[model samples]
Target: MSPLLTVEELLALRSSGSPRLLDVRWKLGGPPGPDEFRAGHIPGAVYVDLDAQLASPGSSEAGRHPLPTAAAFQQSARSWGLNSSDTVVVYDDNGLLAAARLWWLLRWAGFDGEVRLLDGGLQAWKEAGQPLATGDEPAPAEGDVTLGEGKLPTVEVDEVPEFVENGGLLLDARPAGRFSGEVASIDPRPGHIPGAVSAPATGNLGDNGRFAAPDVLRRKFGDLGVSDDRAVGVYCGSGVTAAHDLLALAVAGFDADRVPLYPGSYSQWASRPDTPVATGPTEPPLIDAAEARRRVAEGAVLLDTRSPGGREKTGPIEGAIIVDRDNLDAEFDFGSAERHAEVASLQTPIVVICGSVNGSGPVAQNLIGRGFVNVAHVEGGAPAWHELDR
Candidate 1:
């Protein structure tokens, strides 16, 4: 069954036997969700407060937006009249960012029946000329659905360090700035987990505000060293947006059952003085186009991280050792055995280049982790090099 439903499909389902519609519209540091729900929302949709019902209060121990107890979530579900048989559909204006959280939590809470995201969200409904209801929605009948322990995987706060140590990949889904300790508006700390790779959640999205194509997402995760073989886990500012990454992982054909969420994320990690934190860039420091060019002149290896398709589309830079970012560190014949030996030796300076820092950054960091010294990625990347060249 599809994990998503179009507005037209939802309307057809609504006419037959209405699915339990949840208006999950919300924003970080914005006005209350209920206020927005009252102004206008999908007809028969119940307003679910992400802070109130979906999560517990903020605390130093649990971090902001801690998961609600199973009993508490079950009670909240009953209040919303969610039944074992009923299909639940959640939507938000912001491209299923918040909606996916609810979807994930429901499955985590042992919801066996269908729980889907409304594709493209409320805008998709409005764009389809569907009507919305204003003012408060009426109370629903209490449900009899029983709740159970979370079936989906979870990595507790204490387990994270060991997880990373044991060859597991701990992916920090926050932006590069937050990962680099630039500015932390919400959490107390400004850096990422000591060994986490910076795999920003926004990287999963397309320019159209929807998820990127499956192949694109697959390459994106692959670039970060997340494979079906590797043990992968994710975390963000709170547990909310982290689900977005988990969902993206599932959409990219990863088994959602294996991937776990570190609910505490940076918020809890930062609050605890005992936990170690790493600051500054996770990848090799970025160099500008001119600097990259100069380094190339100085006999540094120009490592192009763009995919074969990406390189073909943009045209290749001359004299580059093209190792697609997705296949970083994987054994491959790049030109010849001697060229491979040179990279494997890690003695020379390697200037990694991609279309943007987002793609190149992790690969550079991956190289550094493998004992590469004097490694740097192109700052603004290939376009920056092109500009300077022109």
Candidate 2:
């Protein structure tokens, strides 16, 4: 909970060289990283790839984009010249939302140093006639601080349902439509967990794309029934958008009781029939697994939910798109209402797949929520698909 840094405040730090900037955006399908930075980026800013720099390799236990190990994080900080003594400001494409997550990660890693989100993000910065450097950039100096295991709070999926049953406030960072089960999603199942409340993360953003003011966010959290001490869990399709809320909460002084992130989220929750889920205005969408898989392979697109590393390690389906569990917003932007309408060239059915059945299920359902119409989940994930093919 360092103080909020306005856009101007951050810019002043830039001029004084007191605050170092990190550009954290990447093209999902193209290049190893820093494509945007190479095109042009904030002067003297280092590049932090969301896929490589900020997250741990995906595991069955952690859906995707799990926090980097403390040592790895420390390594990254030092590589970027992020000493514990200086203020660090992060910016991303306004809509990408990776900027905010970077801020949260710093605090989670135990750096009490000042971390701020740039208002309007990089897009706004460019629009304001700010300068951006292109081609090559100068390398950053190594930082002096040693990275340590920082204390950050989080919870697992199995842990949250009980917390919910025990009166834990479940804040879903997706939209109301998706949460209420009014529509279907790309997963095989379409609906949310048993009794979760919707608090779409977008509410945390303002007209300018930066996070809302602390006071404004405090009230928003209040409306969602988040209390200072109430045990709470925030989730999105697969833990990415939800981080937006976690960051918002942090910014709003909920630091003393930072809410935990249910990494798998609805994406994981709805896959297993064992997990209690509500669908259809009161019921969670249910479908036969064999049939779901059959339909998916026949004509559907597979949406991969594992982290970027997970995809690389496990290998993706023959034609599946790489949509990290924590990156639904960007995924939506790349393949949603706007993108899909125009990319009519690819006329194939769509499917959602993750490392486990759990992550794919809800994402499938979420696509249905967005009126995707045709979707399903690969029964076991990469392993299943390979074994089945063999």
Instruction: Tell me each candidate's RMSD, in Å, in order.
Output: 11.5, 16.3
lDDT of each: 0.81, 0.67
TM-score for each candidate, following the candidate numbering:
0.75, 0.65
Error of 2 at 141 (Å): 2.5
Candidate 2 similarity to native, TM-score: 0.65
Which ranges of candidate 1 are over 4 A from the true structure? 284-390
User: For model 2, how does the per-residue alpha-carbon lDDT over 1-390 read when each residue is reduced to its tens digit?
Assistant: 443465567777767877878888743345545666788888878888777778777544455566678888889888898887888888777444566667767877778677777766777778778888886676678897665544667777768767888988877776656776675564446667777766667667764666667876785576456788788888877666777778777777785336777766776676555777666421123334454466565444556677777778877666556666565555555456534332132222466677777877778666545534334566666676666556
The residue pairs that clash in candidate 1, if any, are none
Residue 79 of model 1 has an lDDT of: 92
The residue-level lDDT of candidate 2 at 198 comes to 63
> How close to the true structure is residue 221 of candidate 1, measured as C-alpha lDDT?
75
lDDT of 1 by residue, 1-390 (tens): 657778888988899997999988788988788888888799999988888888888899999879999999999999998999889999988878788889999999998778888878888888889898999988999988887756899999999999999999888877666777766546776788998887777667664666666766685577567899999999998888888888888888888778999998889998998999897655566778887898788667888888777788777899888775665535333444434554544334678899889988888876655434446788887888878767
**Which candidate number maximizes lDDT?**
1
